[model samples]
Target: MSGERRRVMILAYFYPPLAGGGVHRVLSFTRHLPAHGWDCTVVCAGPDDSWIRDPSLLDRVPAGTEVLRVGGGSGLALLQRLRGARTSATRSSTTIGWLRRAVDWFAFPDSYAGWAARARAVAARRLARGDISVLLSSSPPDSSHLAARSLARRFGLPWVADFRDPWVGLHFRTPPTPWHRARHRAAERAVVAEAAVVLAASHTHERELQALRGRDGRPLARSVVWLPNGYEPANAAASADAESPPRSRDGGAPTASTESRFLLVFTGTLALMDSTFTALEALARFVRARPAARSQLQMVLAGPYESSYAQRVAALGLADLVRLTGSLAHDQARALQRKADVLLLWKPLGVGYRTMVPGKLYEYLDAGRPILALLPSDDEAARMVLDAGGTVVPPGDAAAVERALEAAFGSWLQGGRVPERRPAWLTGHARERLAAELAGTLETIVKGRR
Candidate 1:
């Protein structure tokens, strides 16, 4: 290219105005890459009502950044609607099962396979114009990597495939049949073999990718890098002021002393698979054992939860102690985190849970409050919290949680002053620094081509 600054075309299906934790990583990359002499152009899905839409996130995008919005309908939402219709029909169970299997087989990596064509076409047009110097694709709807692989091969460009979540070995989904599993493995191998570099969100994920071998029995990718998620300092600074006092829905300051009650806050999606039930049980146990403690403690769940979860909390007779604030915007959630006396982090109970770390961990640390993490001792999240001077208890250990709560409550009662010691490791994971590291890696790839 003629310009001194190299360009990277990012293919991400999840981008802002779609509100979720998944968009932050790519958004940060786009925001900071320019400072490191790497410009970015993002191609992502267009607005869809079926998904949670947060127009406020658009403000976070860097000015003058070119974004290509592709509209081909949301394949994932369409599949869910079809499944609902099939369930309502009088079709045989076997037939419905077969149809679901067919969809899974055809979709390959994810239901958003349909978006691959449009994304590739947009990237190809830019590449043909001598615009994009390198290709970077991030995924969960792994179809983005498939598109990147095809375009890279066609245009002879160096590609970096980033896996935010494991494709085949994901613990949340039911295991596929032998044939489907083999096909998924083959596709993963192909992407790894073709890409110049592979990026995994965790060290464990990097090790897994490094273990994959090509058809010639050689290591799959030329290099595999661990590109973990991080926190944005600006967002942290904006919400840090919330630590002053709790606010009402109308943004009114606390009428009573904020220290009158020990506030524990959890912010994120609440699902059956997560440790929500375990945390609630622990709270109930603690309250029931010492009824007076309930008067001085309150736990707020600042996210959407199933109706059954509320019912369960009521059944436990701890409804008065727990508040479920449906769903809040990203900034609002951070504000809540900042106001809390203790932030709660829970890892879902399942196989491979130890290898994964939730994106919220960084935000929790950035909040500068004490964290009570309910996760396995061996998990990466647990290690980070411990390193950052936070508390940790094994998942499902109500007794341990109760003890921790009791101690935290006692500390709150006596002055409520928790020392703020930002861990040294946190500086290494800052969004700007990580983006600079990535920029250097991309520069290395671009220079090699020259």
Candidate 2:
């Protein structure tokens, strides 16, 4: 109503300073879309309320980018539901977490149930202005898409559903029960059917979304597109001052000259499903086989680790070999990646880990460090590393890991380095390119409306 630019509502559960997989995808697009003929209004939950957020990441956004933080509302009202749940000595914290995990797996649409009410409220208010050209929702917290689906019907606005990861896919670890899986799939069908355009972060995701829509007996619209995740190259290249206490890594200068003795780095939350334990086991075995590797290797686990798991790690007697560096600022993690000799990637053996491509792989590529990919056999991360001209060791195979470590050490001693060929596919321009693709999809949607 006020300007020439088409107004778009970006409903993302994760936004800047919320340094997670969804953060970069949503943040970068909203940051750069002005040039592509769209003005964005990001609607997301408050960072303070999120499990993780990176306010600093917002520095890259255009000066006047409008961000609206809605409450984690009735969707998250389960805290009240579980508040009076039983507490017992038999129910240890680990058991409790698993219980929550079980509840999460079986709970259809409940994972993001907390944010639904507030997201709907915000979208309703924003779209009521009648100037919102498109309603875009990013999923997993698929609840946001549900909000957008509801808003689209209410406001008669064309909707764009952005799938950073597919809601129903090979990557999802759904409930074993058929009913639960069906409920989840039904929700996915509903959201996809209602969207004017459906976007996926990878070709794999796009294919899966197509299949899901096909399974639902919906129209085969040309609105689906693969918009792979990307890094902010200029921001990646920018240097951090030495005087500032390195915000993310081991609390030292990010551009430190001397190599950290035995320092292996991993960033991101150490989930129960992550292969951190297996990697630690491998590192322990590597040191046992090669004493020099032990003397030189300082394995650094970055990100938040579950306390119970940390105790398990201590029990493994890796207190000396493993340096538990707590969570760092997003930029700090990048700085640490810059200094790391071997960036570590770990994927769990079962369920969700195999099909998922960790977004951090792009960051690792941008870091230009040789990756020590400890992934499931034939997992996405392994493929990326191999494609990127890096090395990989199978997850949970301590013997194979030992062999890989020996070869890595021997190669390093012989000056073996990860090849300098930047995979033509990997680049920061993806966000801009993706925005253009989405714009075209929107154009198709706009045309169909006429």
Candidate 3:
């Protein structure tokens, strides 16, 4: 269908080895884009940092893709290294709190502020070779876009800016000073104005980005894209050495022992689980109302969790009911999801909250497990859950959270499996399908430049 593949450069700070929601979204593209007649050259942070690493993800990277790792920056990454080997508690440690405060005080664009200069220097050489036609930058550190913006200005190449989350409207903040707010807004507006095209991961985000205006009072960018996150079902099974699907010691489906209990599993970074403490109260209440149910119910958190979560679990007398598995490799995490009777997703309502959807929501749907989501009913994340036949309860509604817990457990106790409902439209959320959408967008951008 094509003669030669088009080459494009991608800048993503949270790529493979650095496990999280954003990593998979970028990884999926790299793996599937080559088939779409595109060559992906990714620039990401080195694996030597103290951040959570999922080495298995490297194997999933297509052999044809080029991944260049660069190191620099005094961000939270540097701060984490100072804590020695307490990597398991990386999320719960004091580093996160310090990082948040630091953002308000000094790290202008973001904590990886210092990393931008070095990244630009590296990317500058790659672009000078004349093989790259277009550029794409994905963000959370926001510094990636800053670097891409600079490179675009200097090289005169069109750049595509991807927002996994908003810059000025980011969730969870203590309200910055008027000066900092203006600076953030100005930076965000500049990016929107300069990017050739902007891709937003949330529907609400696309609408917000499209509303931004330039200094001349015009629409910010040429176009704003709504490209939501998706899940990849093939990566785990592609490698012979990868984690096999959830199985007990006998190499069969989850053991009868696991089926005998109501196992609720959650896998991902637990930093933003705002209503979990209140939800813990519900769990305690569940156990108290039916003391016998305590032995029948258990929740396993299969990713990095803050020490605060452990403390809260202990205080609410749920230490026995809740188990934290620190961190699991990417394939292992998906396998864990397959074994769960119910998956947990929680997001508390806040300003800009509806605009932020965690990447794991798609993975939860792909896992075909009933998701118990504690979210605002109006949020897009809540809609995804309901569409996929999952249950959603309003955050901070203890009575509703308890009811969800009670009902899920009741179903499990009756030797029933909540239907693993896969809607006809869910196939659209596959990684390959999403990559096709991206290929279409990238093709349009590249052709327009010619």
Candidate 4:
């Protein structure tokens, strides 16, 4: 282990071929870790119906990196299958409601818990060879960390638990029942206590993790690191260069024309927590004030969205101006972002949101288009937007959003110029650079174990 390159077993339930923003961080790590004297073997869940699968993502994984795909029983898949059949007999029933609750209460942490036992068995065999240096587990399905904790304890390996999102204090998810809450809280504490280091995706998350204590009321882990999400510079640059259209004379907004409508693009899942409805309301207000601009404006939601969003657009009479493009591959989404006149981000209003930076934010910044972010003025995402030369308006304020859109529209009409992002700012957020920093942290933990 001393002379040979360090080997890390990365347990990420969400990995390549899974079409979502969550895969990028781990993908980048596996791509760049070898350059920094580390090699990665990824253990991830096999394809499931729960998410859109993007086989193209597998091409991005570095050559020589071993990826072990383990199949597991997905609670989400089962629930979706149950809900898929809505017979007339069952349409007005309370049974489906009760079953939904049961699934929520039992799926501790996430549906991927079934993957943990399989992953542990795979990890155990890998560790027995005495070649692996450390265990790294990233999560949203916090189950990955749970498995890593068990493996580390059994194998006496230093474990690094990475939290891409909060487990117990998640903002967007429904509050679990009291029993489920206690279970999540206890499980989170156990993982944190066992890991040698914990990596949080945001500063606020770091502070929250640092404050966590075990059941005995003692601090869980001695070290917690802040590792925010970032953009892959090479991919971003290439996509923008190859796919983006020429900017309008006024600004980086795409050239305005009858065919080239003022496009506002939003990528990713449009969940209840997203500010889609708010954006729609603002668009409605904008169109009402300037009815002539209706034909000129267009909003493209370029990822999976709830069916309710389509109904909302129709209800608000915005179907003419809005296009709901169901889930696209990661590369296609980025291409759409690069081609956009304005990129849209909606951070829901909440104190917890201050610590949450959507993974898309970095990509938005990298896209180098004018960003119209509906977020609190003091939120972490807002700060990043401002620093990257994007515009920010408070979340849930339709008037403010309307004003920002008007300003962007006016700038486009006036032949205004897009501001150049600070080179220093952009450099700091490159995925390779962040991965190097992560490598250094992993090195320290490995050395300390000696």
Candidate with maximal lDDT? 3
RMSD of each: 5.0, 4.6, 3.4, 5.5
TM-scores of the models, in the order given: 0.87, 0.86, 0.92, 0.88
Q: Whose TM-score is greatest here?
A: 3
Clashes of 4: 2
Can you write out model 3's per-residue Cα lDDT over 1-450, one digit (the tens) per residue?
A: 246788779998877777777788899889998888889999888775545677777878898888888875347667666664344424644657776787667777777777777778888988888888789999877888989999999998889999988883334454468777777777887888889899999999999888877668888778998988877763435343234433331234532244567888888877757677767888888889999988787777777777788888888888777876665677777777876899998864577677888888887887789999888888888998898888988888788988998888887777677766666776787889888888888888877888
lDDT of 2: 0.67
Model 3 — which ten-residue stretch has the worst lDDT?
Answer: 247-256
Of candidates 3 and 1, the better by TM-score: 3
Candidate 2 segments whose C-alpha is farther than 4 A from its true place: 1-4, 73-96, 105-107, 168-171, 213-222, 234-262, 351-354, 416-421
lDDT of 2 by residue, 1-450 (tens): 123567688888778656666688887778767776677888887655444455667777777677888765333334423654321111234644665565556445755565767778877887777777888888777778888888889888899888877663224564566777777777777777767778877666677667653645775444677677767652644445412333322344432222636357787766554567777777777777677666666666766555565665688777776765555667767776766667888754565545467777788887777788877546666888988777787667777766776776676656644444457777644567766766666656666786
Candidate 4: RMSD over Cα atoms? 5.5
Residue lDDT tens for model 1, 1-450: 235887899999888876566788999999999998888899998766134455667988998688998876456456545666311101233443455465675666666778878888987887898878899999867889999999999998899998877773333444467776777777878888888889888887788889887778888789998988888863545544333444432345443444567889888766543477777888998888888887788888766554556776798887778876654567877877877899999855776555577888888888788999998887778888999889999888888888998898888878775766568778788889999889888988888887
Model 3 root mean square deviation, Cα atoms: 3.4
Ranking by TM-score: 3, 4, 1, 2
Alpha-carbon lDDT, every model: 0.76, 0.67, 0.78, 0.76
